[model samples]
Target: MRKQLTQFMFSILLLGRAVAALTPEAAENVPFYHIPSTIKYADREIERLNKNIQTKPRLEDSIQFKAFGFHSDYLPVLSEIPDQPRWTLDLTFETYTGIEELFLVPTMERRIGRNYNKNAPYGFPSHFRVSQVFPDGRIQPVYEHNGKPHLSRMPLFIAFPEPRSSSVRLEIFKGAVEENREFFALEEIYATSFSYIRRAQSVKVSSAIESPPFWGLNYLFDQQTNLGQPLGPKNPSLSPKQQKDFSANFGHTPPGCAEIEIDFGENRPFGWLILYPALWPEGILIPGYGFPGKISGTIIPENQDGLRGSSSEIENWTGGSPGNNPVRLHGKGHIGRWLKLKLSDFPQHNGDYIFAMGEIRMYGNGRLYPVSGIRLEGFPKTEFADHMFDGYVGGQPVLFFKDWFFKTINGNTARYEKQKWEYTRQALEQRLDTLLRSTAMSIAVTTVISLGISITVIRKNRRKKIIELRRQISSDLHDDVGALLGCSMLAARHLEETLSNETDILKVRRIIDSTTKAIQAMRDIVWVSSDNQDSARQLAEKLEETLEIYSGKYEVSCKHDHLLNLADYRLQFSEKRDLLLFIKEALHNIDKHANATRINLQITVKQNRLKIIITDDGCGFDFRQAPGQTTGQGLISMRERANHMRGIFTIKTSPGNGTEITLELPVKKKPSPLKPRETTNESN
Candidate 1:
C-alpha cells in the first residue's frame, strides 16, 4: 500500500507538470522556442490558431507574450524574398503576470511566420521608424513613417533602409495598442544579432518595354528606361511627382492630340483612373516629379471624344488640385477589351508645345492596372522615350492617412481588418448555430422515436430509422442540391460556349470548373452517407466514377473499371465514410496538384481482400521530401484518412516518374459479387 501510494503521488505530480506546461504562468519561465517547421500538423495548427484569433479578436489580449512569440513564428508564414534580409521584432507580454520582454531576433526569417510579408517592403507596416545600431550600441539615422517616432505593431517587419547596416535597433512606442492615441504607450528600443543569410537571386519575370501602338495616333516620344516598375496588380496609385533628382523620363504629345488603349482581354468592370505627372520616383518625370502644366484626360468611345470613332467620350480627370493633383476618372461600369485614355489638353513647356505627363494609373477591380494591358500611341521618339514602361515606378506604393485618395476611395485599413474578423466571426457563429440545431433535432428525434417504439423491437427499429434518415439526407444532399449545382455548372458552360468574347468564356469556364468540383464532393458525401452504399464493391465503383469526374476538371484523361473480380465487402458506417473521403481526397490531390494528364484506376479484390489503386502520369513528387505550399495539406490528409480507416496506404513515385497510390482496407463481410463491369475510359 505504501508503494502504491508513492506511485500515485508521483503520477499526480507528473500530471500537474503537464498542466503547468500549458499554462500562461509556466510559459514565461521558458525562454527559448523551437522554430516551427511548416509541414503537416504545424501548418494546420497555425491555421486553426489564426482562425481562432480572427474569429475572437479580443482573444489577442488574453494571449501571453511568450505564447504570442512562439505562435507568431508559425501562424502567418510568408515566403521570403531573395537578397532581402527580412527582420522581425516582437513585444512579448505575460498577460497573467503583466510581465513583458522586447526581442529583436534578426534571424533569416522564413516566409511562413505570423509576421511574414508576402510582398516585402510594399507589404511591410506602413507606420514605423527604423534605426541601425552599430556594434558600439549607438543607433544612427532615425527614420519615421506616418509621422510617428515608434516601431510597428507586434511581429513588426521592416526593410533596412540601409541594408549594409545589419546591426539594427528598433524603438517600439506602442505595440499593437489601439490606434490614433497620441503616444499612448508605443516607445521602446532593442538591440539585434544580425545573422548572415545568403539567399538565391529572386526570379521576377520582366521584359524590355516595347512602345505600344498608339490609337488616335499623335506622335512617338523618346524610348527611355524611365517608367517605374510594375507595382503589382493590386497597388492602386503612386505619388505623381519626383522628390529625388533621378526623375527625367518625360514625353509630350503634339498640339494635335494623344491617346492610349488598354485591352483587359475581357469586359472587366473598371471604375476610375488617376492621371498625374510622375512625381520624382512615381515615374521618370523631371525635377519635382510634378507636372509642368495643367492637363486633362478622357476615355474615347471609338467614335466619341473627337477620336476616329462614333460614341460619346467620357472625361475622367483634370489637373485641378495642389501638387499637380491627379484627376479621378469614373468610367461608371465600362466593360470591354478596349479602354481609351486620351490627353485632352496640356500647356507647352521647354520651348515645345504639347501635352505631357509623368505617370498614369488605372484603377479597377480594387487594384491598379499598372501595365498588364495598355498601349501607347504617338510618341516623339527621344533618347529617353522608352523609359516610360521600363518598370521603374517610384512613389508611395501604398496610401497613408494623408493621401487625398485614401478618403476618396474609402480606405479603412484597421476598421476593415476588424470587418474581416467580423466576417469570420459570423461564419463561425453560423456554423455553430447549424451544428447546435442539428444535434438538438437529432437527439429529440432519437428520444421520441425510442420512447414511442417500445412495442417494436426498440434497438432494431431505432437503427432502421437511423438508416432511413441517412438515406433521406443523402438523397437530399445530392439529388436536390447536387442537381442545382450541376445545372448551374452546365449553364456556365453554355454561357462560355455561347459568349463571343474569349475573356468572358474564360471567366465562365472558371466558374463551371469550380462548380463541377463542388458537385463531385457533394456526390461523394452522399455516396458515403446513404445506407445502400455500405458494400465494398460500391466503394470501388464510386472511386472509379469519382476519379474520372475530378480528373475531367483538370482536363486530364482517366481510365477506370478494368476490374478482375469484385467482391461485396460490406463496411460499417465509419469505414464507408472514411473510405469514401479517402478516395475523394486522393482524386482531389491529382486534380489540383499532380499536373497529371492521364489517370488509371484499378479496383481488385482477391480471396476476400480488397485493394484500390490509383495511378497518375504527371510531374510526380518524392513523398519523403518537405511539403511545399501545394502538396503539404494533400499528403497530410491522405495519410490521416488512411490511418483513420486502419488501412495500409502507400505511394510510389519520383520526379517525372508519375505517382501510384494503393490502399488496402480490411473487409467486414464477403458476399457474392458480380463480375467487373466492362467500361472503357471514355464511358463517363
Candidate 2:
C-alpha cells in the first residue's frame, strides 16, 4: 500500500508540473508615444492641401487611388503605367541600427461596422520583401513573405535576422489586380529594438494620397487605436458593473444635430480633452455606436457671455468617429472655463437618429479636473446628461491604459497555451489506447500456445499408463501360472519315484490334478489379459469354462444364469484379475481338503452391484477353528483378494454344515487402466 501511495503521489507531482509549465505568464506593460513624435512620411497634394499617406484621422479613411480614366489625362493612362505605379516606403535612421521584430497592421483595427476584404488587403501584393539598406547602398534581404491569403485583423508580427542598416525599405509591386486602378492601404507599422518598440518614423513614400485632417501621413503617428485604453487580463466590457444611476434613455431622438456643454466653475488651463464613445447594455449598441460621424467643438473662457451668439473663444477643434477608442484633442495654448461640442450624423436606430456617449475626461496641469456641471441642448432627453462623466464605459470602469493593455494581451497568451495543451493530451491518450490493445492481443496469443502444450503433455502421460498396465499383467501371469506348473513338476517327480515301487495310482492322480490346476491358471491369465473380454458377462463365461474343466475332477454346476444379464457392465483390469483368482483359490482349497460331492455357483447383478455365491456339499469345519498351512493360506488369499477388489467376503460353515462363500462387488461401467497391486496385512 505504501509503495502504491508513493507512486500515485509521484504521478500527481508530474501532472502538476506539466500544468504549470503550460500556464502562460502575465502580459507586460509597454509605453508608447501618445502624440506625434519624430515620424515622417511622403507628402502629396489633395484639394490644394498638403497630405501624406501614412496616417488617417478617421477609421474609414484611405489613400488616393490611381486608375486610368478612358477620357482623363491628369492621371497616368492605364497603358503608360501597366507595369508602373509601384510604391516604395522607406524608414531612415541617423545611425545604422537593427530591429528584432516588426508589426504591420494592414487594415483598420476596429471591427465595428466597417466592411472590407478580411483575407489579405484588397490590393496588397501577392508577395513582398523587407530589405536593409547599408551606408554603401548594398541592399541585403532580411525577410520575405509568400503573401498567402489569411485572416488579416491582428497585426502581422515578423522577426528579422541579425541585420543592421541605416535605412529599411518596403516596396509593393503593381499588377496585383487586372484593373487599371491599383493602390495599397496600411493602418500602422511598429518596430521593436531590444526591449523598446516604437511607431515607424521618418517614412518616405514614392506616391501617396494627399488629404487633410483624416487621410494624412502625420495622423498615422498618433498612438490612437481601436484597442482603446489598455485593459487588464479581464475585459471589463464583457462583465461590467454600472457606476452611474441611469434613469433616462438617450438612444431615441429625431434625425438632427445636438450640442453639449460643460462648465468648470473657474477658468482653468487645459491641454487635452478626451472623448469616449458610448456602448449600450446587452449589445444594444456596438462599441462606438451612436457616436457622431463628424463633430466640431470650441473652448470658451469663463468671462465670455456663454450664450447662443457668444463670440469669445479660447481654442477651436474638430473630431470625427473615434471608433471604440477615445479621441484626444490638444488645447492651443489657451485657458477655458466653458467647453461646447456640436455633433452631427448620429447613427440610425428604428428609422430615427440616436445619440449616446460614455464619458468625457479633461486634463489640465497634468491632472484631471472635476467638472462643475454639464448641459445638454437640442435633444429629446437630457435628464441623464451627467451619465457621460460617470467614469464608466458600457457599465464597466475604464482602467488605466497600460493596465488594460497588459491584461488583454496576457489573456490571449494564456488561452493559446491551453489550446496547445489540449491537443497534446488528446494525442497521448490515443497512443495509450493503441498500446493497450496490442498488449491484450499478445496475452491472447500466449494463452492459446499454453493450452496446446498442456494438452500434449496429458496425452503422453496417458500412453505411459497403458504401457505400465501391460507390464503389470505380464507379472501376474508369471506369478500365478508358474507356481502351478512347478507343483505339477513336483507331482511328476513323485510319480516317477513311485513307479519303481509298484506303480502307485495315488501319485499318478496327484500329477493329473496338478497339471489340470496349472492349465486352469494359464487360461485365467489369458482371459484377464485379453482386451476383448472386459465386460462383466465375459468374466462369468470364463469362470464357467474353468468350472467345466474342474468338473472332470469334482462335480460343479451353476445355480442360476444371472451373469449373462450383466452384458452392459464392464470391469477394470485389476478387478477382473482379483475376481478370477479369488474363485480359483476357493475351488483349489475345496478340492484338496473337502470330500465335496457337488458344487454350485451363483452370480447375479442388482442395483449396479455383482454378487457371487459358491457352495459345497462336503464335511465342513468350524468357522472359527485354525486350519492347516495350505488351506489357511488359500482361504486368507481369497479373502484378501476380494477386499482388494472393494468387495465384501463372507463364509458360513459348521462342523456338519456345508461350506458357503459369497462375494458382492459394485459394478464398474467405465473402468480405469491397471494400477500396481497394493500390499495388505493378510499377506504379512
Which model scores highest in TM-score?
2
lDDT of 2: 0.59
- The root-mean-square deviation over C-alpha atoms between each candidate and the true structure, in angstroms, is 40.8, 20.5
Residue 611 alpha-carbon offset, candidate 2, angstroms: 45
lDDT of 1 by residue, 2-68 (tens): 3433543554464454444334333233222221221223345435545433322110111111101
Q: Which candidate comes out best when scored by lDDT?
A: 2
So what's the TM-score on candidate 2? 0.43
Where does candidate 1 stray beyond 4 Å? 1-457, 490-502, 550-565, 623-631, 670-684
Q: What are the lDDT scores of the predictions, listed in order?
A: 0.46, 0.59
- TM-scores of the models, in the order given: 0.29, 0.43
Worst 10 residues of 2 by lDDT: 34-43
Q: Which residue ranges in model 2 land beyond 4 Å of their true spot?
A: 1-87, 90-103, 108-152, 156-185, 189-204, 208-257, 263-269, 284-287, 302-325, 363-372, 382-386, 396-406, 431-684
